[model samples]
Target: MGILLLMARERVPRVMRGEIPMASIAVERDAYPLKARLLSNNFDNQFQLPVLFYVGALLAILFQPGWPEVVLAWLFVATRYVHAYIHVTHNRVGKRFMAYAAGLAVLALFWLWLILRLLILAPSI
Candidate 1:
């Protein structure tokens, strides 16, 4: 996504006008203008809660989750798509936050379910 963002930025004539050097962005958070900055921030956001999703997915694979877990996983991915759409587009905080919170809730439930499954399936000492 970061590479894609950089490629997209190159296509924008204004970004290529040399107003803000690309190098500056690495050193300064505010180097990119509003839209570019928002995109950068959104790209950075992919790493946050999604890291947990990756772990949960791995665990799910190892544990052989049922249909319910599969549904929750899809729901979580869907919410993230909605959140990123709102973030990079209109960027209405209220709506974006709702999507974010929904994803977080689903993620928490996913982890909880995984933990419970592990405990229930554990062998007796």
Candidate 2:
């Protein structure tokens, strides 16, 4: 959630203030600005994908989804957070790509499931 990210950012400033004398935070101040920009860009993209997903979902509450679909959708949301975490924390490119791919797979599968359900059920109307 964006709120969670904001809360996390607030803690960093507080922690940095506490540790300035020791320079415990390893990251450079200038580098953080660029890192932050990349973070925001990813967050923006993540938010947009879910908005479009739910819009399709809203169009067809005629039949609510089963548990797996809902769970997978939630997994996509969690995976996005994981994607951002691996990217900024460990800086592991391979891990970041894996997280991102997992999220995309969930989204794409959810979309296809919703579309097929709607089309198959359309004959009843």
| TM agreement with the true structure for every prediction | 0.82, 0.61
lDDT of 2 by residue, 42-101 (tens): 666666667866775565454777665678678877987798777656658899889878
lDDT of model 1 at position 68: 63
Candidate 1 collision pairs: none
The candidate scoring highest on TM-score is: 1
Clashes of each: 0, 0
User: After superposition, which runs of candidate 1 have C-alpha atoms over 4 Å from their true positions?
Assistant: 2-7, 10-17, 121-125
Error of 2 at 119 (Å): 0.6
| lDDT string, candidate 1, 9-118, tens digits | 64356547877666776567576566776777777888999999999899888878877679989999999989988887799999999999999999999888877777
